[model samples]
Target chain A: MENIALLMHGFAIAFSLENMAAAIFGAVAGLIIGAMPGLGGITGVSLLLPLTFGMNPTTAIIALAGLYYSTMYGGAFSAILLNIPGDSPAIVTSLDGYKLTQKGLPGKALNASTVSSFIGGTIGIIILTISGPLLAEAGLAFGAPELALLVLFALTSIGWLLGDDIPAGLLATAIGLMFATIGVDPALGQTRFSFGQINLLSGVSFIPLVVGFFGFSQVIDMIISGEDGAVATKVRIRDCVPTGKEIKMMLPVSIREGIIGTFVGVMPGAGATTSAFLSYIIEKRINKHRDEIGTGSMIGVAAPESSNNAAAAGAFAPLLTLGIPGGATTAVLLGGLMMWGLQPGPLLFTEQPDFVWSLIASMYIGNVICLILAFICIPILVRAISVSKKVLVPIIIAVCVIASYANSNAMFDVVLMLICGILGYLMKLADVPTTPMLLTFVLAPMLEQYVRQSFDMTRGNPSIFFRGGICWFFIVLILLVSFSPLIKNFYLKMKDKKAN
Target chain B: MGYVLPGLSVLMGLYWAVKAFGYRLWVLNGPGGGLFPLIAGILAIIFGVVMIMRRYRTKKKSDFSVKSIFPVVSVIGIIIASYIIGLIPSLGVFIIAWMVFYEKEPWLKSTAVGIGTALVFYLVFDLWLAVPLPMGLFELI
Candidate 1:
């Protein structure tokens, strides 16, 4: 009953004229950006961050968060139409989606993707609404020792998850933690890492790092990879709206994926990449028409698309409850939360229940607004595909430069972006996934502070780590990931011998 | 590209390691300031070495081509030129001009498009939103 009152308050916050308009704008923009290959909700939100400096924080947050779901829907259109995914989640849609397009079921694939995204996204929101505070309550009971272990566990798990190559990811994370310490030490007044540079004293800004790493570097890579105008491909499935008969066929699978995806999304370390893979696997193993799994079936597009969005929304669970970021986009969203002057943690529910409730309420309205605008703009956005990439790249670069400069009007940021962009481009050339860098960028500060704080509390006694089984659990997890290379190599060799 | 790129990352890593050492290790009762970055620097260098070795061990194909330099260099050159001009609008003007010339659009059409785009952006970002933009030669506005 109390939840009902809070939800009503949430509706009041979301239904406002200004908030509604922003949500609609975000929904449209999210899909547009998401449709572009190699860009996703993260890129869209990052691109729009500069524009949010002036608006009310709640308004800005509402709009940006809306982009996450809208992009999920928009990305499906691209996958089905162009056979290219805007992000990890949309990859599966491309398999059956493009095949469906060749068979002229582009309309069904696109429609299925949108409806499934809507279903998955909404269910994920419901879970967030009800379960967020419940978890936050449990998280508050956790002491400093628990948090210290959690951060380490996350870093170690992510390190091992990137492959048997734990060093590179850990090194990247260490750099991030070091970078986090650059500013005036909160504990002590002494500037530790500044090395006499004025800008260093303030610590590196999150804006430049995010923009350079994701945005500017993206442009550079796009240029390098021969911008094929791949994004401009339009979805022209004959029926822009789904037929009643088609809806009936796709309803069960879409709903099931939405449920499965929401649960997958909530779990830590289970990102969209794995979620989509599992959804495809599940669809094949359980579907009534299993043989139709890969050959342009509507279920193929529905399952993964549903799961990915659910996961994206579910990715919010850990971050909101425990203040732990679950993915790259969520990490940037953390930056947004900070920019809004609100921290995501256990105390948020106690201290600012209104803010918490209102944000959740906004998602409901935001998702609906996204659906309406995306439905309307499908034709115009698809027509944009005909625009030549040779013409588009220059225009995009100009906008990016202006946007980066506008964020703070700082020349240093522009220079910083160029350097990072070059390095980002180089990293891409080297085959080191940029995903780890983003995760590192998120975890760096928390890792440093928690380790220091825990160490101090323990008075140099490493036993503080073992006081709770929590730390041991994470340590075990990391060990498993660390030894994964040997296991993976053995498995491969066994398969090779069998083939011979 | 292989040796030079990884070699450069290693060099940067070494530089950071030296800088990290300049900060005292473990402030009293606290983790030393260099704790995170020094570790990071060393790891980055190690990873760079691994990448360099793997590049050779696998004899992997290079997706990069030499012609890629033209787009990068030209875009960078334009950015530098804009800084030299010390005018945001002039930079905007030059961007459209470069596009026209590089793409071989007619000068008249290019100038017209440049002027129109500059005005729209100036009005949208500056006049309406009132964002402070560099005025350069047209400081009167």
Candidate 2:
């Protein structure tokens, strides 16, 4: 009941004029950015983050959060119309979405995707509203050791799950950790790796690093991939309306996937992409019209679309409650929270109820706003998908330079951004996933602080890390995640031997 | 690219480990500044070694070409030009050049986009955000 009262208060905050405008602007911008190929939530947020430098923290977060989930709605635009996924999560959507386009039912696919995104996003927000505070309350019991173990669990899981090559992922994780150690040491206040440069004193800036990694590397990719303009397909708004039976068929699937996606989002390392893939696989197995899944079925469009949006919402649970980012986009948002000087953790709920609750409350509004904007702007958005990559490539490069410079008004940061961008491109060329690196970069400093605190508490007793149930629980999970690859290989070999 | 990346990782691990040792690894039983970096360095070395070994066993042919470095070179040119002219002007020139020369767009349209984008950026970053973007030779003038 008290939580409900707080939620009402949150609604009041979200209803404020500034916040309302932020949400609307974010929705429009997110839709356009999401509809563009090769740009995802991470790049979109990184580009827009600098614009919010002077805004109130709550308003800034509200705007970014609005942008984050609306991308899920917008991503379906390109996938349904042009056969190119606007984002990674929407790759599954394109399988049936483009097939539907081929069958002259692009309108139906778009409508199904939009409706399912809304349903899944709404359900996810409800779960977050219920679970966020509960999770925060539970987190209050954790000590330094448990916190350290939990961070380690998150890092190891990300390293294990992000790429096909485990060694490559581990290398990325190590590199991120090493990067975090560049500035003054968190514990002893001793500078570790400054190499005498003054800019190195404060460490590498997050904005420049992120802009370089996600934005600038993308520019490089666009330039290299060569330009191909999407052929515009006309779909009138009237053509976008779905039948009652179609809505009914999508509703149950959306609800089920939404529920599942929320839980998946709450888990460390598993993100919207995973959630969407899992939902589609499950839908393939169980749907009444299973055979029609890849044959332009509405259920195919709904299943992944709904789950990805739900997972986007679900990702916030861990981020708000435990200060742990569930995925790469949330990791970037976590960095934003820190940049805003708002510490995200259990205390965030008690310390800043207005901030936490308002952000949560805004999600519901953002979902509705996204849905309406998606429907009304379909014609324009389809055109946006056709915008020339030649034009986009140069504009993104300029934005990257400006964003990196705007961070601290230093040209050095711009140079750093370029370096990181090149590095990011090289990493991609080597098939090394950069997501774990970004996640680790954000979490490594926090892990250092917790580990040091634990060591200080126990006078460097290694046993301190194994003291409590929470610590042990995290330890067990970390070990299991770390060795699961080996276990799987062994099991596969045994099965093959048996078959022989 | 495959061999280069793992080899770079190995070298970086070596450098990091040596630099980390300069800081005390421990202070009175508690971890000092060097401990975490040392751990990271060691992990990097282990992972890099494994990656290199796997690459060696596979002996996969590298598909890398010098062509991919063109974007990097172009951006570096822009950075150098930014120092000579200004960030806004250099970016405007980059847009015009890329569109006109690379995309083969009409001069009128490319110029309009170039100047228009630069103008918007100036208004936002300078007038609104007050970011004090680099003026370069403009500052000297």
Q: Chain A TM-score for model 1, please? A: 0.60
Docking class of 2: medium
lDDT of 1 by residue, A1-500 (tens): 77768889878887889888888788877877676544567777877887988888778877888887788888777567654455656656776886676565555666778787777778778877777656434434445565566555555555432444554455455445545667765444567666677766777665556545555666666666765544444555355577787678678877787777766565554556556656766786578876787777888888888788877777776777677766677788888888878888878766767766777888888777766776666555445544555555555555545555555666565565666666666666766655466555555565666667777887766677677666677677667656756788999999999999
- Give the per-residue lDDT of model 2 (tens digit) for A1-500: 77788889999999999999999988888887677544568867987898898899999999999999998998888667655466767767876887786565677888899999999999999988887756434435566787678667756656433545777888888878878888988677888788787887888777677667666775566566553422334445576688899999999999999998887677655678767866776787578988888778999999999999999998898898888887778998999999999999878989999999999999999999999998887655544434567676677677777777776777888888888888777777666666567667766876888888888998888899988787788888888878878998999999999999
lDDT of 1 at B64: 71
DockQ of every predicted complex: 0.37, 0.51
Fnat per predicted structure, each in turn: 0.29, 0.63
Per-model TM against the reference: 0.67, 0.69
Model 2 stretches astray by more than 4 angstroms: A1-135, A159-164, A221-363, A374-382, A428-431, A493-500, B49-61
In CAPRI terms, model 1 is classed as acceptable
Worst 10 residues of 2 chain B by lDDT: B61-70
- In model 1 chain B, the worst 10-residue window by lDDT is B82-91
How accurate locally, in lDDT, is each candidate?
A: 0.66, 0.80
